[model samples]
Target: MSTLTIIWIALPFFVGFISYLLPRFDRIFSLGVAIASTGYALWLYTQPPLKLQLLDNFGVTLLLDPLSGFFILTNGLVTAAVILYCWNSGKTAFFYMQTIILNGSVNAAFACTDFISLYVALEVISIAAFLLIAYPRTDRAIWVSLRYLFTSNVAMLFYLVGAVLVYKASHSFAFAGLRESPPEALALIFLGLLVKGGIFVSGLWLPLTHSESETPVSAMLSGAVVKAGVLPLVRCALLVPEVDPLIRGLGVGTALLGVGYAVFEKDTKRMLAFHTVSQLGFILAAPEVGGFYALTHGLVKSALFLIAGVLPSRNLKELQHQPIHTPIWIALVIASFSISGFPLLSGFGAKVLTMKSLLPWQVIGMNTAALGTAISFAKLIFLPHQKQEKQGKIQPGFWAAIALLIGGLFLANIAYYEAYSFENIIKPLATIALGWLAYFLIFRQTTVKLPRLLEQFDHLIGVMSLMLILLFWMVLA
Candidate 1:
């Protein structure tokens, strides 16, 4: 099992390194790595959980528990679809190299039980993602990637400080070390994770960064990369069950705020990016079930971003009149509807779990976010798809989109396997109906402009800092 874990973490890094020597086979190498990692994750999931402690004196360890296994599966599935989509396209060898390296980083991040190793994995993921985001070499791409680099370094720095505090308080940096730690310390750490996880104010950078990056990069960003910050929080919640209430508060806050912004956004990728934040809120709201919640959301969100890659326009209004190819249209609606928690889909199950044990207000907040999510997705599923008959010649990357949708649905249902109760089926229908009405009545013609100052780098930093201070006050009060 340890050997397999090593293979799971090393194979992508090894393939990526060697691919530089044989650039001619970059596509083949990348495809092979993707398929292998994805298949291994799916297979490993059915087996028992495993953990390998390393450097116990320093509290460093590796984990393949159900939480890690579930997220690893999510990462692999998204990477497989991305590699397939990028195949035969004219991406540079550097693109494949960075992408594959990031794949390794995400796997390692998910599997590590210690903060030291997890932080290392996240830093590597950041560098690789920065390179991939800047792959186009355009001025705007470089600019966005730079912002990503800056924000990531800042957030990780906070995380390191928080980890140091943890070590000071409890004499360990492992998940087990979090016991008896101060709330101020945990709050500092959660704030850092919240920023990288794209939650609320700390995540304000996400909309611009994701919307500006290339489509494939956007898919990777919102889908796999964002999970770097999320799983650790899940681990913390598992280890320190006292923090569950805090996690719930953050999750509900993030869901409502993100979906509110997404409802009025006009850009296709931008809107989905906000939804990424929103869906993550749902995942966080149910920390107990967050493994599968994150898995299902990650897969569906990745599919949606990749579909946006092939669209003719990023503007919602423009897409409304555009005649989409029929099959592509179906792919769009399924992924959209799935994310909206439509009946019998992956989201429906995930959402039911998210609603479990919520307080009255939390439940109301999450449900309202669900309604907003439905309205936001309705823009894609209903608007300009009326042409219905335009069977234009299949575009490039079309089949890859279909594969992603089908694969995501299959994994969520088969691996996660949440049963459909009568209540689960009936609840989302009312939200869906309300969403439709709200979309037509209120959100359809609404145009909202967020304060520009809030999006600036200094402002984003200020918000994070203020959050840390507030967290400290709350913890100490």
Candidate 2:
């Protein structure tokens, strides 16, 4: 690794230690460290990939590719935003710990090349996320976070077993070297990674934990943390495209279930969390059908979550009752549109790219996923505070986040026009219209009216089935 890459990993650790040692000066130190790290990550993205061999005989290697660079940018960008958002929230030590560790783990995941290295990186990220999500010590927070911890630890166990199997079968831990081994090892690797990636039932715990956390923490969990799974999944895609038919089926099932769950969810944050799992399903499905839409989905989804993190409410209820008519609500509206694939939004480029990249299996299955996402976010069309009240001025950090989000829009437009066609834009718009219609018919009423039967059953099934599903996917897929 180059000096810059070394700093990329080291800066966060330095800041984390400093914040821990001197908790009084956390905000200043935290913001300074986050901005520097984000700036460094962006700079690194523009440079050539640095290759390094860490373990000699194991052939351990590291390289920064465009996909990894994109996520690195996301991890840094969102970490900076969250830290800034919490600047005056008076929880400096907690925020610093979560932010610094989250950034470090994400950077590590992006840089790892060997299974052992990747596993360690992911474990760090997951644990840091668990801390962030459960930072608040309320009963609900503890219960939800414990659920996240249990599911993630189980996923880690699956990963370890797979690593041992691969080592026994391939005699090496490097992803490249392992690829040259038997296809069965590759299959096992995918199975393990899929559990981490939050496939359907395997990831049932995601929605509960993600939505129950604080806004900034939820943003980290959604924008930077969840993408950790995608990092390994994307890399593994090259090795194991045909790991398990059940994995692909689970991807589709998760996509469907996520949308279904989100469509009826009353809480704003929980709905957003469900969408994350749903969106990941789409990404997982894409690679299965031999397309790169999964990468597109991951990037766009990460950006959307970062923007959503800055919103002022945890649910439609809060946004509805709280005084809006402020710049922040407007910004949130833009984010909703962007996530919903509105015309001239970043999501539009991503959706168009995804549609173009699809094969037969993806064309139909993921099309539904897109429409479901549109419907889930459709509540946003009428969801913002309808009435006006005394509003506070937007913070500088809020503006900073908006600027970054709008910049993302410009980048998305470039991607679209470079690969653009009239037909591409038309199809996504038509699908959006279709989604609007479906939202009116199926989801409009029940979204606000909580169904006791479904909610109870989801809680029961969601909690109980996650482990079984994860193990089954690991073994069968």
Predicted structure with the largest lDDT when compared to the true one? 1
Could you give candidate 2's per-residue lDDT for residues 254-360 as a string of tens digits?
78878877888877777788888887776656443222233334334444455555556666657665555545556666666776777776566666665565556
- RMSD (Cα, Å) for all candidates, in order, is 1.9, 4.0
Measured by TM-score, how close is model 2 to the native structure? 0.85
TM-scores for all predictions = 0.95, 0.85
**Residue 309 in model 2: lDDT:** 56
lDDT of 1 by residue, 1-477 (tens): 788778778899999989988999987898788888878877776778887876557855887877777788778778877777777678878899888899899988888887788889989988998999888889988988999889978988998988898889888788777777887777778887888888877988998999888877888788888988888887787788777777788889889989988888888998999999888888788787888788888888888888787777889889877867666778888888788887657877787777775667688899889999999998998856545554554436658755865667755765445557787778888889899998989888887766557789888888988989876776665
Model 1 TM-score, 2 decimals? 0.95
Off by over 4 Å in 2: 177-192, 244-250, 287-323, 384-389, 392-396, 447-477
Q: Which runs of model 1 end up more than 4 angstroms from their true locations?
A: 386-395, 414-418
Best by TM-score: 1
C-alpha lDDT score of every prediction, in listed order: 0.82, 0.66
